[model samples]
Target: MKLGELLAIIRRDELDDESQPYLWSNAALIEYAEDAENEACRRASLLRDATTPAICRITLVAGTSEYDLDPRVIRLRRVRLTGNSTPLVPVTTAQLDEEHPGWEDETGEPSCYLTDWETGEIRVVPTPTAVGTLELQVVRLPLVALNDMEDTPEIHARFHRDLRHWIVKRAFSVLDSERQDKDRAKDAESRFALAFGDPLSARTEEWNARNLPSTHRDGSE
Candidate 1:
């Protein structure tokens, strides 16, 4: 299947959990993942066009509370085109520390650090004891495609590492967007309350704005 088709399946399969609040209640998280996946597919297509290996990097900003809830959450995975099939690979802590040394703790787990990419840099630190956020980045490299196709453990291992980076980065984007949306909501609520002197009404309006249908409320004749 094409990359886009594969992504559709991945999103549907991996993100189909209805019990997760991030997946069910947060549209931003869902949309963020879709966009990240689409970007990865697009990059993959470009690599295919150039006949060169491509690397995609995705980074996520997750709250400390979220991370504490599930430290081992496998946030990202990817599938790449192989000889006759697509293989899925999970991103892991070991790979991240390899690409960016000293980024993880001595135990081979992720640790807060200052990450700099071509576009920008950010200082990542755990949030308060109960509340923290994670930052994720995905990088794509085009130079390794040919070697990745080789039938050897080394090739598979490298591909797996690359796939993990891409997937984690994509997952991070989902978390970051959700945090932004919450911040935006809070800001909007604050502004409305200041303007109207009625926090309850402002909250109600915000909820209505988010969920109400676009059509006229009266169902006009």
Candidate 2:
């Protein structure tokens, strides 16, 4: 659904009189809509992109093992040297330490990759001796704010309806004299979780623990 259509429903459901003054202004609602899309991307992995060069391609610097991922990237899925058929395997610092011992000081083509989500960096094993490009697949948050004027969300068409649940959740719980409705707000949040899946913060904690290279010492799997 487009932003305009979504806004219309939110207005009607919330008794937001567009003809009259509204507690939930268009600007605020747009922000809420943006929040919902971002949350969906974070928890549900809605946007899986492989071809966006700005986010999916990295230039490897000779002797540089580590590189920053795009800020919007929520998860890194794969990495491959531009012309190589073999994909770099995921590895952990602890695992590397156990096997290679001072692997960080070595130099060669990267055979494995390690990610630290907390720092938004990926380290390629055996810093490259020749500069080249790495192709990537990633899950990322939306690149821009919702263009309430005419643009629709980057979220897929099927998931667009579910996005409204998030907007309603935020809109109703707004701490305003006329707008605050805790019961409805709570209900909306519950429905959104049902539609999108997971309480994101709790899910994030589990995800971080599972993905932390230190925790996954046995990389043989």
Model number with the top lDDT: 2
Model 1 scores a C-alpha lDDT of 0.30
Q: Candidate 2 regions off by >4 Å?
A: 202-221
Per-model CA lDDT versus the true structure: 0.30, 0.80
* Per-residue C-alpha lDDT of model 2 across residues 1-221, encoded as one tens digit per residue: 78888788778865455675776788888898899999988778888788998999999999898899898887766678898877787777889999999898999999888887678788898899999998887778997879574768998899887888888889878878788888888888889999888776756743753363131223222
TM-score of 1: 0.18
Tell me the spans in candidate 1 whose CA falls farther than 4 Å from its real position.
17-165, 173-221
lDDT of 1 by residue, 1-221 (tens): 22333334434644443444544333433343334333333333212221212222222333321122111111112222222122222223455467756533222222333322222333333222332223221222233222112212111222222232233234433445443344444443344333324322434533332223122223221
- Cα lDDT over the full model 2: 0.80
